[model samples]
Target: MMTHTETRSAVLSIGRVYCDLIFTGLDHLPVLGRELFASGMEIAAGGGAFIAAAHMAHAGRKVALAARIGMDSLSAGVEAQLRESGVDLRFVEHAGDAGPQITVAAVVGQDRAFLTRRAGPALPATLDAALDWEEACHLHIAEYATLHEIPDLVSRAKEKGLTVSLDPSWDATLIYDRGLLRACEGVDLFLPNLEEAEAITGSADPQVAIRKLSLAFPLVVLKGGAEGAWVMSSGRMLHAPAETVPVIDTTGAGDAFNAGFINAWLNGASEEMCLRAGIRFGSLAVQAAGGARLLTTAE
Candidate 1:
């Protein structure tokens, strides 16, 4: 297995952070004006960046998270959880008065719906200054919106001699914008789920979307939940099947996959090996109640 010492690299993840209130064991989503009961509920440190960073840390990777969080009672617990997960929090900044960003995730079987209330601006002025680029071998941006906010992020990372990866987490507004395509320029790796890829490229087919994305980025990793994932690298295409696992919540599965793939990639593993690592991590993610809970004990 790949370890932090072997890679000698730390993953720097940037994006928003949230306190995820997950309700699991729901029979189905609630209809309008109706209330439903869930068998279990838990609050966990969440957001794409946190989940990915936590999983990376769990895999013995030196990982750091850079984001803005409110300095409130709710945020205290969330921050503690992140630190306990072994993610370096030196870059995390405090947003005063504004409370912690809270997300209500209603999970039913393998699917989930989220309602979020962001506390303040996604990025703080201290973000860029806080980043220790010298310590980062790879930078992972959790969402396309964050990239939009910092247009020079990829170029800046490249200038620092760090490879960059981005997961275009579904942004309803930006997916239809052609500017989204331009935002991906110079990114070493682009990861987007099948649906997000289709929306961004205006293509109904995953293959077509992958082809279009491959033209923009050197590597394109298309995540297909149950069908597994597809990797397009250097004009070559490869597939990795998903590992069957009991479903609990699908909240952070994709982020976990990102961590696994990146850990393997940093270790100089093959494309197939990276894909398999991703599937393995994703499988573990869904077997637990919270987003990165399983990662805390991951091997």
Candidate 2:
């Protein structure tokens, strides 16, 4: 049974969670016959949902993670971190098929590459309960893949009277899907990286891609690495420059930005302020090797 709350202050974040193995400071990517050495490595609880939720919680926003994780050894490896992330985990479903989801990230210079494996269904059993939680007025879908897996999620959340946001996390297979706009029909906010926007809109021009996207989504925020971010809404386009910071690893920087932007937007911040907040969070993300590193020292 879900109980109603007076304040709609919490955010419900839905997506998959993974145990991330991050390697930073590599000279180059690994070749077929050659093994590359990295200067540093860290194992952390990751995934678009977890990373963004962690940051949101770190920023003093109440967040609930509604996703699935495995009940396996790999899941055990990240249990401690997840428990300490400060994001509510009551909605996380632990099942045999959900275990062993993993992402291996290799960072060389300012660029990074990832190899990932996803197991089980993306939807969690507690999804409906999480959505019905009275404290949550907003729903953040961490990845387009999750939206694809649960096509009616946006409408379902909207039916519950919660505003919805979606991040089109880069997926080689789904980036070019012609049905993307349709799948995101009821999303209030659409966040995408420059590459994703270009791929989806089939245009190298960021402005053109964003303009086209704005026609579908009420708000469009495009994350541009190094070049900052762009926002399109209500027939207006806004741009914010990213801060130049020392680069360590860029594994989940975009997701961190999503947290900052979403949090501010939910709080009624101006468009420019939201972009600035996102840039601030993203700057902190690249200063460390892992996505949730700031939270380790947040308090």
Leading candidate by lDDT = 2
- TM-score, prediction 1: 0.94
Model 2 clash number: 2
Tens digit per residue, CA lDDT, model 2, 193-274: 9899998999878899999999998899999999999998898999999898799889889999999998888878889988
Candidate 2 global TM-score: 0.96
lDDT: worst 10-residue window of model 2: 1-10
The Cα error of candidate 1 at residue 36, in Å, is 1.0
List, in order, the clash count of every candidate structure.
Answer: 0, 2
TM for every model, in the order presented, reads: 0.94, 0.96
lDDT of 1 by residue, 33-118 (tens): 99899999999999899999999998988888889888888899898898789898888888784467898999987889989877
RMSD of each: 2.3, 3.0
Clashing pairs for predicted structure model 2, backbone only:
70-98, 70-99
